[model samples]
Target: MLRRLELLKELLLLIPLGKVTTYSSLASLLGTHPRAVGAMLARNEDLVVYPCHRVVMSDGRLGGYALGKEFKRRLLELEGVKFCGPERVCKESVVDLKELLS
Candidate 1:
């Protein structure tokens, strides 16, 4: 499980600039639960290196960040991630992890 979490972290690092993904999508790719992905991200100590902020909720909601939701939004904004509304990211800007790994 630790190894898998490490792999998930590595995969997260591969999220290109300006691209974002959902916890559910990542869980599907990793063959784990969305909560597991969230747990792993919550425990991630290296924010910049791991880029956990790139992961959002399935509904495009900004979701949780260790720093803060506002900070996460700012970081995503700097990377060119667009929002659908005030709280959710634009679906067009989301990264498809399955296609990405393929």
Candidate 2:
């Protein structure tokens, strides 16, 4: 479990400056659950290095952040993550985990 969490953090660090990914995507790629990903992220101590804010819900919702939703939204915005509406990120902006891992 600890190893997986470490790998998850490492994977999260790969999220590019302007891209985002869903929690479900990460969980699938990591062979874990979305809630576990969220739990690990919630306890992550290195916010700047991990870039956990780039993760969202599978449905494109901006999911919770250790810092708060607005802060997460602002960070994503600063990184040029596009939104589909007021609260969801555009589907096109989602990062492909397979491509990233490969």
Candidate 3:
């Protein structure tokens, strides 16, 4: 559990500036399941610092947001990420700045 906590903690810091990542991608970074990442994010206590809103669904869908789906959308929008296309892929966005947030 401690190791998983560390992984979640580290993954939280990887979210980018003005861009979002999918749950599956994050889980893959830790060699775990997307559901596990989602569970960790859901139980996150340092929300403001971790920025859980930057995580979305792999299929470009906004999945379960512990802070509320609208809040997630608002947060992402503030970062200049907009979902579009028939599948709702993040569109018209700048570069994926994962390095910045990390």
- Those runs of model 3 whose alpha carbons end farther than 4 Å from true positions after fitting are 85-102
Clashes of each: 0, 0, 0
Best by TM-score: 1
For model 2 the local lDDT of residue 25 reads: 83
lDDT of 3 by residue, 1-102 (tens): 669878777766766677777777777667789898889888888888887777777767778777787777777777778778533446444233333445
- List model 2 lDDT by residue over 1-102, tens digit each: 999999998889888888998888889988989999999999989998889999999889999998889999999999899998888999888987877778
**TM-score rank order:** 1, 2, 3
**Model 2: pairs clashing at backbone N, Cα or C within 3 Å:** none
Give the clashing pairs for model 3: none
Native-structure RMSD, model 2: 1.0
Task: RMSD for all candidates, in order, please.
Answer: 0.8, 1.0, 3.4
Query: Candidate 1's error at 19, in angstroms?
Result: 0.8
* Order of quality (lDDT): 1, 2, 3
What lDDT does the true structure give each of the candidates? 0.91, 0.89, 0.71
Q: Write the residue-wise lDDT of candidate 1 on 1-31 in tens digits.
A: 8988889988898888998989988899889
TM-scores of the candidates are 0.95, 0.94, 0.79
Worst 10-residue lDDT window for candidate 1 reads 93-102
